[model samples]
Target: MGVVERTWSWLATGAHWSGPDGVWHRLGEHLFLTAVCLAISCAIALPVAVLLGHLGKGGALAVNISNAGRAVPTFAVLVLLLLSPLGTHGSWPTVIALVLFAIPPLLTNAYVGMREVDRDVVEAARGMGMTGRQLIARVELPLAFPLIVTGVRTAAVQVVATTTLAALPGGGGLGRIITAGFRLTDTAQVVAGAVLVAALALLVEGVLMLAERLFDPVRRRTGPVPG
Candidate 1:
């Protein structure tokens, strides 16, 4: 049988869809890791980026430091974490590694987005008696929203793809499926696991893109005016 047929047969097996080690369960684990890591990374990166952007000071240094982190491989980080005290605490090492992997883009995009906001607009808001908080809330954030969301979309997709690495440390996720298939020399199962991860990543990208367009203030403002 061809590899495609074999993979299809493997997928069609009902047993694969049921039980604790099933695709459904693995997908849930994968998504849970992705969600937690994404949320934590956002919480850590966005505020710092936005604050630096708002102040228009120290942003370049911060962005450079974050971008430097991108050079380090996440698997290497996970390995180091696994050798540390946190490794014994279930999924904490995996979560921390993934969060580190996710932060650079979030920081870079948000900081760049905020810095990119028009100076004139900021000045006008201030001229209109807007305080620092009001200017950021009403002007900067709204204007920077698209890039910020783009950063989120980028990070989320990256996290979804990278979460597979969690299986290395016995952390649950679709990576388990792939790792198990490797151990058993089951090429079909490995391919199926890869296909699933790729599909999930694409789905996340599409959903976030739709959301970006839906909530885009620029799109809303430039939309057709009533007659």
Candidate 2:
């Protein structure tokens, strides 16, 4: 009964918005925080993953470390950061915490993807006079791109959902509503916030699918894709 009520309440969230401006403004803030955290996490993770992958050393060790990172509770990490240099009171700090939450997936995907690129392909490129950068840009990254896209897709969804944790720091998101709902015992608002989060997840997943298709080298190799 609680679950059904929650779902119905979520469905009805949109009707409670006071005006177009308020609705768009709040949603826009949510998106801004989500994008910022996502971008920061990917930027930091990709290069490190690629470098480690290219080194072809410590692959298993690196993966285990990331696994540990994923294992540690995100809320614990966030509280620690808030107490330290992160200060925990600002939106950017919340963004930072979310980025930390996002790192394991992005790092694991990029590193593992590049590592999985066929060794023969790397050797062939080397034999053909490809430089280090050329080997990466043309050969390894291309092959690994599919896996990388999968990582980004996973990260996108995870980041969007996790950004709700930003509410702990007074950052805007559906979490803001959820927090308010918790304090007020307003299950309707809680359900509404959860609904917005689910919708946002779906929207994020759709956009990333388009990105994955666009970047897929396998599709490019097969034929000219329609614009």
- Give lDDT per model, in order: 0.90, 0.79
Task: Look at candidate 2 and give me any clashing residue pairs.
Answer: none
| Candidate 1 to truth, TM | 0.95
For each candidate, what TM-score against the reference? 0.95, 0.85
Q: How far is candidate 1 from the true structure (C-alpha RMSD, Å)?
A: 2.1
- What is the per-residue lDDT of model 2 for residues 76-174, given as tens digits with 9 covering 90 to 100? 766677778657457656777788777888888888999999999899999999998888888888899988888888988987887777676566776
lDDT of 1 by residue, 16-81 (tens): 978999999999999999999999999999999999999998776767876698788888888899
What are the RMSD figures for all models against the true structure? 2.1, 3.6
